[model samples]
Target: MPGYKTHMAGAAAVTGVAVAGIYWLGFYRPNFESMVCLGIFSILGGLFPDVDTDSKGRRFFYGAALLVDIFLIYKQQYRYAAILGFCALLPAIGSHRGWTHSWWAAILIPASVLVAPMVLLGLPWQPFVPYYLATVLGYFSHLILDGKF
Candidate 1:
Protein backbone atom coordinates (compact mmCIF):
# COMPACT_ATOMS: atom_id res chain seq x y z
CA MET A 1 0.00 0.00 0.00
CA PRO A 2 1.24 3.41 -0.87
CA GLY A 3 1.52 6.05 1.83
CA TYR A 4 0.03 9.52 1.53
CA LYS A 5 3.06 10.99 -0.22
CA THR A 6 3.20 8.14 -2.68
CA HIS A 7 -0.55 8.25 -3.25
CA MET A 8 -0.48 11.99 -3.90
CA ALA A 9 2.47 11.82 -6.31
CA GLY A 10 0.93 8.92 -8.19
CA ALA A 11 -2.45 10.66 -8.32
CA ALA A 12 -0.90 13.81 -9.74
CA ALA A 13 0.86 11.79 -12.43
CA VAL A 14 -2.33 9.93 -13.24
CA THR A 15 -4.34 13.15 -13.37
CA GLY A 16 -1.97 14.53 -15.98
CA VAL A 17 -2.25 11.36 -18.02
CA ALA A 18 -6.05 11.31 -17.77
CA VAL A 19 -6.39 14.88 -18.99
CA ALA A 20 -4.02 14.19 -21.87
CA GLY A 21 -5.82 10.98 -22.75
CA ILE A 22 -9.16 12.74 -22.86
CA TYR A 23 -7.75 15.48 -25.05
CA TRP A 24 -6.10 13.04 -27.43
CA LEU A 25 -9.14 10.82 -27.65
CA GLY A 26 -11.16 13.84 -28.79
CA PHE A 27 -13.47 13.42 -25.87
CA TYR A 28 -12.24 16.73 -24.61
CA ARG A 29 -10.51 18.32 -27.64
CA PRO A 30 -10.98 22.08 -27.78
CA ASN A 31 -14.19 21.95 -25.79
CA PHE A 32 -13.77 24.49 -23.03
CA GLU A 33 -16.74 23.34 -20.98
CA SER A 34 -15.59 19.75 -20.99
CA MET A 35 -12.12 20.78 -19.90
CA VAL A 36 -13.48 22.95 -17.13
CA CYS A 37 -15.85 20.23 -15.95
CA LEU A 38 -13.05 17.71 -15.94
CA GLY A 39 -10.91 20.06 -13.89
CA ILE A 40 -13.64 20.42 -11.31
CA PHE A 41 -14.20 16.70 -11.11
CA SER A 42 -10.47 16.10 -10.93
CA ILE A 43 -10.10 18.29 -7.89
CA LEU A 44 -13.04 16.79 -6.08
CA GLY A 45 -12.25 13.22 -7.06
CA GLY A 46 -8.61 13.48 -6.06
CA LEU A 47 -9.35 14.68 -2.55
CA PHE A 48 -12.38 12.52 -1.84
CA PRO A 49 -10.83 9.20 -0.93
CA ASP A 50 -8.29 10.67 1.44
CA VAL A 51 -10.92 12.69 3.24
CA ASP A 52 -11.71 9.62 5.32
CA THR A 53 -8.55 10.02 7.30
CA ASP A 54 -7.56 9.54 10.95
CA SER A 55 -5.91 12.88 11.61
CA LYS A 56 -7.92 15.48 13.50
CA GLY A 57 -8.01 18.09 10.76
CA ARG A 58 -8.35 15.45 8.08
CA ARG A 59 -11.43 14.13 9.82
CA PHE A 60 -12.96 17.57 9.87
CA PHE A 61 -11.96 18.07 6.28
CA TYR A 62 -13.57 14.78 5.44
CA GLY A 63 -16.79 15.85 7.10
CA ALA A 64 -16.71 19.15 5.25
CA ALA A 65 -16.12 17.40 1.95
CA LEU A 66 -19.03 15.09 2.61
CA LEU A 67 -21.23 18.08 3.27
CA VAL A 68 -20.05 19.62 0.01
CA ASP A 69 -20.80 16.45 -1.91
CA ILE A 70 -24.25 16.19 -0.46
CA PHE A 71 -24.90 19.86 -1.08
CA LEU A 72 -23.71 19.70 -4.67
CA ILE A 73 -24.88 16.27 -5.81
CA TYR A 74 -27.54 15.17 -3.36
CA LYS A 75 -29.12 17.85 -1.25
CA GLN A 76 -31.61 15.41 0.18
CA GLN A 77 -28.58 13.76 1.74
CA TYR A 78 -27.20 17.07 2.99
CA ARG A 79 -29.15 17.02 6.22
CA TYR A 80 -28.00 13.53 6.89
CA ALA A 81 -24.35 13.97 5.96
CA ALA A 82 -23.10 15.11 9.33
CA ILE A 83 -25.24 12.69 11.26
CA LEU A 84 -24.39 9.84 8.92
CA GLY A 85 -20.79 10.96 9.00
CA PHE A 86 -20.79 10.62 12.75
CA CYS A 87 -22.08 7.11 12.32
CA ALA A 88 -19.57 6.39 9.60
CA LEU A 89 -16.78 7.30 12.01
CA LEU A 90 -17.42 4.40 14.36
CA PRO A 91 -16.65 1.55 11.97
CA ALA A 92 -13.90 3.59 10.42
CA ILE A 93 -12.41 4.14 13.84
CA GLY A 94 -12.68 0.45 14.56
CA SER A 95 -11.03 -0.60 11.33
CA HIS A 96 -9.04 2.31 10.10
CA ARG A 97 -6.18 0.48 8.45
CA GLY A 98 -7.65 -1.83 5.85
CA TRP A 99 -11.09 -0.28 5.47
CA THR A 100 -10.71 2.69 3.14
CA HIS A 101 -8.25 0.76 1.02
CA SER A 102 -10.85 -1.29 -0.74
CA TRP A 103 -10.90 -2.12 -4.44
CA TRP A 104 -14.65 -2.75 -4.39
CA ALA A 105 -15.21 0.99 -4.38
CA ALA A 106 -13.66 1.36 -7.83
CA ILE A 107 -16.38 -0.69 -9.46
CA LEU A 108 -19.22 0.43 -7.24
CA ILE A 109 -18.47 4.15 -7.11
CA PRO A 110 -18.13 4.76 -10.85
CA ALA A 111 -21.24 2.74 -11.57
CA SER A 112 -23.27 4.86 -9.19
CA VAL A 113 -21.71 8.07 -10.49
CA LEU A 114 -22.64 7.17 -14.07
CA VAL A 115 -26.20 6.39 -13.07
CA ALA A 116 -26.67 9.19 -10.56
CA PRO A 117 -27.60 11.89 -13.06
CA MET A 118 -30.02 9.65 -14.89
CA VAL A 119 -31.99 9.64 -11.67
CA LEU A 120 -31.08 13.10 -10.37
CA LEU A 121 -30.84 15.28 -13.47
CA GLY A 122 -33.40 13.40 -15.59
CA LEU A 123 -30.96 13.60 -18.47
CA PRO A 124 -31.62 11.48 -21.54
CA TRP A 125 -29.43 8.48 -22.21
CA GLN A 126 -27.49 10.02 -25.08
CA PRO A 127 -25.56 12.84 -23.42
CA PHE A 128 -25.59 11.15 -20.04
CA VAL A 129 -23.55 8.15 -21.17
CA PRO A 130 -20.56 9.97 -22.66
CA TYR A 131 -20.59 12.68 -20.03
CA TYR A 132 -20.70 10.13 -17.27
CA LEU A 133 -18.03 8.05 -18.95
CA ALA A 134 -15.76 11.06 -19.12
CA THR A 135 -16.40 11.88 -15.49
CA VAL A 136 -15.75 8.27 -14.52
CA LEU A 137 -12.43 8.23 -16.28
CA GLY A 138 -11.42 11.40 -14.51
CA TYR A 139 -12.64 10.16 -11.15
CA PHE A 140 -11.33 6.61 -11.40
CA SER A 141 -7.77 7.81 -11.64
CA HIS A 142 -8.09 8.97 -8.06
CA LEU A 143 -9.43 5.61 -6.93
CA ILE A 144 -6.60 3.74 -8.60
CA LEU A 145 -3.99 5.94 -7.03
CA ASP A 146 -5.60 5.31 -3.65
CA GLY A 147 -3.75 1.97 -3.67
CA LYS A 148 -6.21 -0.49 -2.24
CA PHE A 149 -3.55 -2.49 -0.48
Candidate 2:
Protein backbone atom coordinates (compact mmCIF):
# COMPACT_ATOMS: atom_id res chain seq x y z
CA MET A 1 0.00 0.00 0.00
CA PRO A 2 2.79 2.34 0.85
CA GLY A 3 4.42 1.47 -2.40
CA TYR A 4 1.23 2.33 -4.20
CA LYS A 5 0.95 5.65 -2.45
CA THR A 6 4.57 6.39 -3.15
CA HIS A 7 4.12 5.69 -6.82
CA MET A 8 0.95 7.72 -6.95
CA ALA A 9 2.79 10.65 -5.51
CA GLY A 10 5.50 10.19 -8.06
CA ALA A 11 2.97 10.02 -10.84
CA ALA A 12 1.35 13.25 -9.73
CA ALA A 13 4.61 15.10 -9.49
CA VAL A 14 5.89 13.72 -12.73
CA THR A 15 2.76 14.46 -14.67
CA GLY A 16 2.54 17.94 -13.24
CA VAL A 17 6.14 18.77 -13.90
CA ALA A 18 5.99 17.32 -17.36
CA VAL A 19 2.89 19.25 -18.32
CA ALA A 20 4.09 22.43 -16.74
CA GLY A 21 7.41 22.12 -18.43
CA ILE A 22 5.81 21.48 -21.77
CA TYR A 23 3.48 24.42 -21.43
CA TRP A 24 6.31 26.72 -20.50
CA LEU A 25 9.15 25.42 -22.63
CA GLY A 26 7.16 24.79 -25.73
CA PHE A 27 7.62 28.49 -26.52
CA TYR A 28 3.96 29.11 -26.32
CA ARG A 29 2.13 31.36 -23.96
CA PRO A 30 0.74 29.38 -21.03
CA ASN A 31 -2.85 30.41 -20.67
CA PHE A 32 -3.65 31.01 -17.03
CA GLU A 33 -6.80 28.88 -17.02
CA SER A 34 -5.13 26.13 -19.02
CA MET A 35 -2.19 26.13 -16.65
CA VAL A 36 -4.52 25.69 -13.72
CA CYS A 37 -6.41 22.96 -15.53
CA LEU A 38 -3.22 21.16 -16.47
CA GLY A 39 -2.02 21.18 -12.89
CA ILE A 40 -5.33 19.87 -11.62
CA PHE A 41 -5.48 17.09 -14.19
CA SER A 42 -1.92 16.08 -13.53
CA ILE A 43 -2.68 15.76 -9.83
CA LEU A 44 -5.97 14.02 -10.49
CA GLY A 45 -4.40 11.53 -12.86
CA GLY A 46 -1.79 10.75 -10.25
CA LEU A 47 -4.32 10.25 -7.48
CA PHE A 48 -6.78 8.52 -9.81
CA PRO A 49 -6.03 4.91 -8.86
CA ASP A 50 -6.57 5.40 -5.13
CA VAL A 51 -10.22 6.36 -5.38
CA ASP A 52 -10.95 3.77 -8.04
CA THR A 53 -13.25 6.28 -9.56
CA ASP A 54 -14.64 5.26 -12.92
CA SER A 55 -12.70 6.36 -15.92
CA LYS A 56 -12.55 9.97 -14.85
CA GLY A 57 -9.54 10.59 -16.99
CA ARG A 58 -11.04 8.86 -19.99
CA ARG A 59 -14.29 10.78 -19.83
CA PHE A 60 -12.53 14.07 -19.40
CA PHE A 61 -9.58 13.41 -21.64
CA TYR A 62 -11.78 12.93 -24.67
CA GLY A 63 -12.51 16.62 -24.75
CA ALA A 64 -9.29 16.97 -26.66
CA ALA A 65 -10.50 14.39 -29.12
CA LEU A 66 -13.96 15.80 -29.60
CA LEU A 67 -13.10 17.24 -32.98
CA VAL A 68 -11.71 13.91 -34.04
CA ASP A 69 -14.93 12.20 -33.06
CA ILE A 70 -16.96 14.73 -34.96
CA PHE A 71 -14.69 14.41 -37.94
CA LEU A 72 -14.94 10.65 -38.06
CA ILE A 73 -18.68 10.77 -37.61
CA TYR A 74 -19.16 13.15 -40.50
CA LYS A 75 -16.39 12.37 -42.92
CA GLN A 76 -16.04 8.63 -42.65
CA GLN A 77 -19.56 7.65 -41.70
CA TYR A 78 -18.06 6.26 -38.57
CA ARG A 79 -20.77 7.03 -36.09
CA TYR A 80 -19.13 4.28 -34.15
CA ALA A 81 -16.32 6.67 -33.46
CA ALA A 82 -18.49 8.69 -31.18
CA ILE A 83 -20.08 5.58 -29.74
CA LEU A 84 -16.68 4.14 -29.12
CA GLY A 85 -15.75 7.35 -27.40
CA PHE A 86 -18.83 7.08 -25.27
CA CYS A 87 -18.23 3.48 -24.29
CA ALA A 88 -14.55 4.05 -23.78
CA LEU A 89 -15.06 7.12 -21.68
CA LEU A 90 -18.39 6.31 -20.07
CA PRO A 91 -17.38 3.12 -18.26
CA ALA A 92 -14.33 5.02 -17.19
CA ILE A 93 -16.49 7.31 -15.12
CA GLY A 94 -17.21 4.47 -12.67
CA SER A 95 -14.74 1.74 -13.52
CA HIS A 96 -11.66 3.07 -11.77
CA ARG A 97 -8.22 2.40 -13.07
CA GLY A 98 -8.17 -1.23 -12.02
CA TRP A 99 -10.73 -2.33 -14.59
CA THR A 100 -9.63 0.08 -17.28
CA HIS A 101 -6.03 -0.82 -16.62
CA SER A 102 -6.20 -4.25 -18.15
CA TRP A 103 -3.84 -4.88 -21.08
CA TRP A 104 -6.89 -5.94 -22.99
CA ALA A 105 -8.04 -2.34 -23.01
CA ALA A 106 -4.91 -1.22 -24.83
CA ILE A 107 -6.13 -3.26 -27.75
CA LEU A 108 -9.87 -3.42 -27.40
CA ILE A 109 -10.69 0.04 -26.18
CA PRO A 110 -9.42 1.81 -29.29
CA ALA A 111 -10.78 -0.81 -31.61
CA SER A 112 -14.11 -0.58 -29.89
CA VAL A 113 -14.49 2.75 -31.67
CA LEU A 114 -15.51 0.82 -34.71
CA VAL A 115 -18.49 -0.77 -33.02
CA ALA A 116 -20.91 2.01 -33.80
CA PRO A 117 -19.96 2.28 -37.45
CA MET A 118 -19.45 -1.40 -37.87
CA VAL A 119 -20.84 -1.51 -41.39
CA LEU A 120 -19.85 1.94 -42.57
CA LEU A 121 -16.22 2.02 -41.64
CA GLY A 122 -13.29 -0.23 -42.13
CA LEU A 123 -10.64 -0.35 -39.39
CA PRO A 124 -7.85 2.08 -40.06
CA TRP A 125 -4.62 2.75 -38.26
CA GLN A 126 -4.58 6.51 -38.60
CA PRO A 127 -6.92 7.34 -35.74
CA PHE A 128 -6.71 4.14 -33.77
CA VAL A 129 -2.96 4.28 -33.36
CA PRO A 130 -2.83 7.61 -31.59
CA TYR A 131 -5.95 6.90 -29.60
CA TYR A 132 -4.60 3.59 -28.42
CA LEU A 133 -1.30 5.14 -27.47
CA ALA A 134 -2.98 7.79 -25.42
CA THR A 135 -5.28 5.30 -23.76
CA VAL A 136 -2.47 2.93 -22.96
CA LEU A 137 -0.27 5.73 -21.70
CA GLY A 138 -2.87 7.10 -19.34
CA TYR A 139 -4.15 3.69 -18.27
CA PHE A 140 -0.70 2.33 -17.61
CA SER A 141 0.21 5.45 -15.69
CA HIS A 142 -2.76 4.79 -13.45
CA LEU A 143 -1.90 1.13 -13.02
CA ILE A 144 1.63 1.99 -12.05
CA LEU A 145 0.43 4.23 -9.29
CA ASP A 146 -2.04 1.58 -8.19
CA GLY A 147 0.86 -0.84 -7.88
CA LYS A 148 -0.37 -2.82 -10.84
CA PHE A 149 2.88 -1.86 -12.52
Candidate 3:
Protein backbone atom coordinates (compact mmCIF):
# COMPACT_ATOMS: atom_id res chain seq x y z
CA MET A 1 0.00 0.00 0.00
CA PRO A 2 1.21 3.47 -0.75
CA GLY A 3 1.72 5.99 2.03
CA TYR A 4 -0.47 9.03 2.64
CA LYS A 5 1.91 11.34 0.80
CA THR A 6 1.96 9.09 -2.24
CA HIS A 7 -1.82 8.77 -2.29
CA MET A 8 -2.22 12.54 -2.03
CA ALA A 9 0.25 13.13 -4.87
CA GLY A 10 -1.49 10.62 -7.08
CA ALA A 11 -4.88 12.16 -6.31
CA ALA A 12 -3.56 15.62 -7.13
CA ALA A 13 -2.17 14.38 -10.43
CA VAL A 14 -5.42 12.70 -11.31
CA THR A 15 -7.40 15.79 -10.30
CA GLY A 16 -5.27 17.97 -12.55
CA VAL A 17 -5.93 15.72 -15.51
CA ALA A 18 -9.63 15.61 -14.71
CA VAL A 19 -9.87 19.40 -14.38
CA ALA A 20 -8.15 19.72 -17.73
CA GLY A 21 -10.56 17.25 -19.26
CA ILE A 22 -13.54 19.18 -17.91
CA TYR A 23 -12.19 22.35 -19.47
CA TRP A 24 -11.34 20.63 -22.72
CA LEU A 25 -14.76 19.06 -23.01
CA GLY A 26 -16.52 22.41 -22.51
CA PHE A 27 -18.87 21.01 -19.94
CA TYR A 28 -18.45 24.10 -17.81
CA ARG A 29 -16.67 27.39 -17.86
CA PRO A 30 -13.12 27.44 -16.50
CA ASN A 31 -13.52 28.90 -13.06
CA PHE A 32 -10.53 29.13 -10.74
CA GLU A 33 -12.40 28.82 -7.44
CA SER A 34 -14.42 25.80 -8.51
CA MET A 35 -11.39 23.98 -9.88
CA VAL A 36 -9.34 24.72 -6.78
CA CYS A 37 -12.13 23.47 -4.48
CA LEU A 38 -12.41 20.32 -6.59
CA GLY A 39 -8.70 19.67 -6.26
CA ILE A 40 -8.79 20.16 -2.48
CA PHE A 41 -11.71 17.78 -2.10
CA SER A 42 -9.94 15.17 -4.22
CA ILE A 43 -6.80 15.29 -2.12
CA LEU A 44 -8.81 15.05 1.10
CA GLY A 45 -10.70 12.06 -0.23
CA GLY A 46 -7.42 10.30 -0.96
CA LEU A 47 -6.31 10.62 2.64
CA PHE A 48 -9.68 9.93 4.20
CA PRO A 49 -9.31 6.22 4.67
CA ASP A 50 -6.32 6.56 6.91
CA VAL A 51 -8.27 8.58 9.42
CA ASP A 52 -8.87 5.29 11.24
CA THR A 53 -5.19 4.95 11.98
CA ASP A 54 -3.18 6.84 14.56
CA SER A 55 -0.87 8.48 12.08
CA LYS A 56 -0.02 11.82 10.64
CA GLY A 57 -2.74 11.30 8.09
CA ARG A 58 -5.42 10.96 10.75
CA ARG A 59 -4.24 14.10 12.51
CA PHE A 60 -4.40 16.06 9.31
CA PHE A 61 -7.78 14.70 8.37
CA TYR A 62 -9.30 15.41 11.77
CA GLY A 63 -7.81 18.87 11.77
CA ALA A 64 -9.37 19.69 8.45
CA ALA A 65 -12.68 18.17 9.47
CA LEU A 66 -12.75 20.13 12.68
CA LEU A 67 -11.95 23.32 10.85
CA VAL A 68 -14.85 22.75 8.53
CA ASP A 69 -17.11 21.90 11.41
CA ILE A 70 -16.15 25.11 13.13
CA PHE A 71 -17.03 27.04 10.02
CA LEU A 72 -20.35 25.25 9.88
CA ILE A 73 -21.05 26.17 13.47
CA TYR A 74 -20.23 29.77 12.74
CA LYS A 75 -22.77 29.63 9.95
CA GLN A 76 -25.36 28.46 12.52
CA GLN A 77 -25.66 25.02 11.04
CA TYR A 78 -25.35 23.43 14.44
CA ARG A 79 -26.87 20.06 13.69
CA TYR A 80 -24.91 19.61 10.50
CA ALA A 81 -21.69 20.62 12.18
CA ALA A 82 -22.34 18.19 14.99
CA ILE A 83 -22.85 15.44 12.49
CA LEU A 84 -19.64 16.35 10.77
CA GLY A 85 -17.72 16.29 14.01
CA PHE A 86 -19.20 12.97 14.98
CA CYS A 87 -18.33 11.40 11.65
CA ALA A 88 -14.81 12.72 11.85
CA LEU A 89 -14.31 11.14 15.27
CA LEU A 90 -15.84 7.79 14.34
CA PRO A 91 -12.61 6.18 13.19
CA ALA A 92 -10.98 6.64 16.58
CA ILE A 93 -13.09 3.89 18.11
CA GLY A 94 -11.50 1.36 15.80
CA SER A 95 -7.84 0.45 15.71
CA HIS A 96 -7.35 0.78 11.95
CA ARG A 97 -8.14 -0.73 8.52
CA GLY A 98 -11.82 -1.02 9.32
CA TRP A 99 -14.89 0.82 8.01
CA THR A 100 -12.94 3.91 7.19
CA HIS A 101 -11.01 1.89 4.58
CA SER A 102 -14.05 0.18 3.21
CA TRP A 103 -15.79 0.63 -0.15
CA TRP A 104 -18.89 2.08 1.49
CA ALA A 105 -16.86 4.85 3.02
CA ALA A 106 -15.73 5.92 -0.41
CA ILE A 107 -19.27 6.21 -1.66
CA LEU A 108 -20.85 7.65 1.46
CA ILE A 109 -18.30 10.35 2.07
CA PRO A 110 -18.61 11.80 -1.42
CA ALA A 111 -22.35 11.25 -1.45
CA SER A 112 -22.66 13.34 1.69
CA VAL A 113 -21.88 16.35 -0.44
CA LEU A 114 -25.04 15.69 -2.38
CA VAL A 115 -27.22 16.11 0.68
CA ALA A 116 -25.20 18.64 2.64
CA PRO A 117 -25.35 21.45 0.12
CA MET A 118 -29.04 20.95 -0.44
CA VAL A 119 -29.67 21.07 3.28
CA LEU A 120 -27.62 24.20 3.71
CA LEU A 121 -28.63 26.22 0.68
CA GLY A 122 -31.66 24.57 -0.91
CA LEU A 123 -29.69 24.50 -4.16
CA PRO A 124 -29.93 21.95 -6.93
CA TRP A 125 -27.43 19.11 -7.24
CA GLN A 126 -25.85 20.40 -10.45
CA PRO A 127 -23.19 22.54 -8.79
CA PHE A 128 -21.93 19.73 -6.55
CA VAL A 129 -21.81 17.04 -9.22
CA PRO A 130 -18.26 17.76 -10.35
CA TYR A 131 -16.95 17.84 -6.80
CA TYR A 132 -18.68 14.57 -6.05
CA LEU A 133 -17.08 12.96 -9.08
CA ALA A 134 -13.64 14.24 -8.18
CA THR A 135 -13.94 12.94 -4.61
CA VAL A 136 -15.04 9.49 -5.74
CA LEU A 137 -12.22 9.31 -8.25
CA GLY A 138 -9.59 10.27 -5.72
CA TYR A 139 -11.00 7.94 -3.07
CA PHE A 140 -11.10 4.97 -5.42
CA SER A 141 -7.58 5.70 -6.55
CA HIS A 142 -6.43 5.52 -2.95
CA LEU A 143 -8.15 2.21 -2.32
CA ILE A 144 -6.72 0.74 -5.52
CA LEU A 145 -3.26 2.03 -4.80
CA ASP A 146 -3.48 0.56 -1.31
CA GLY A 147 -4.46 -2.81 -2.80
CA LYS A 148 -7.69 -2.75 -0.82
CA PHE A 149 -9.44 -4.33 -3.78
lDDT per residue for candidate 3 within 1-149, as digits (tens), equals 68888999888888888889878998766589888888888988888888787666788877878898989989998998988888876888876777777889899878877887798789898789888988987887788888889
User: Between which residue pairs do clashes occur in model 1?
Assistant: none
Task: Name the candidate, 1 or 3, with the larger TM-score value.
Answer: 3
**Deviation of model 1 at 57, angstroms:** 9.9
lDDT scores of the candidates, listed in order: 0.52, 0.49, 0.83
For all predicted structures, in order, the TM-scores are 0.54, 0.38, 0.82
Candidate 1, residue 66: the lDDT equals 72
lDDT of 2: 0.49
**Per-residue C-alpha lDDT of model 2 across residues 1-149, encoded as one tens digit per residue:** 33444544565566555555665787434467655544444444443344334344434445545766787778774765666466545544655445555656444544533342344555555533322333334444656555675
Error of 1 at 132 (Å): 4.7
Q: What is the C-alpha lDDT profile of model 1 across 20-111, one tens digit per residue?
A: 88778976563667656655454444444554565442555566657666685466665445645564464355344344344554444445
**In model 3, how large is the Cα lDDT of residue 96?**
74
TM-score, predicted candidate 1 vs. hidden true structure: 0.54
- Against the true structure, candidate 2 reaches a TM-score of 0.38
In terms of lDDT, which candidate is stronger, 2 or 3?
3
Candidate 2: which pairs clash? 54-92, 54-93, 54-94, 54-95, 54-96, 55-92, 55-93, 80-116, 80-117
Where is the poorest 10-residue window by lDDT in model 1? 93-102
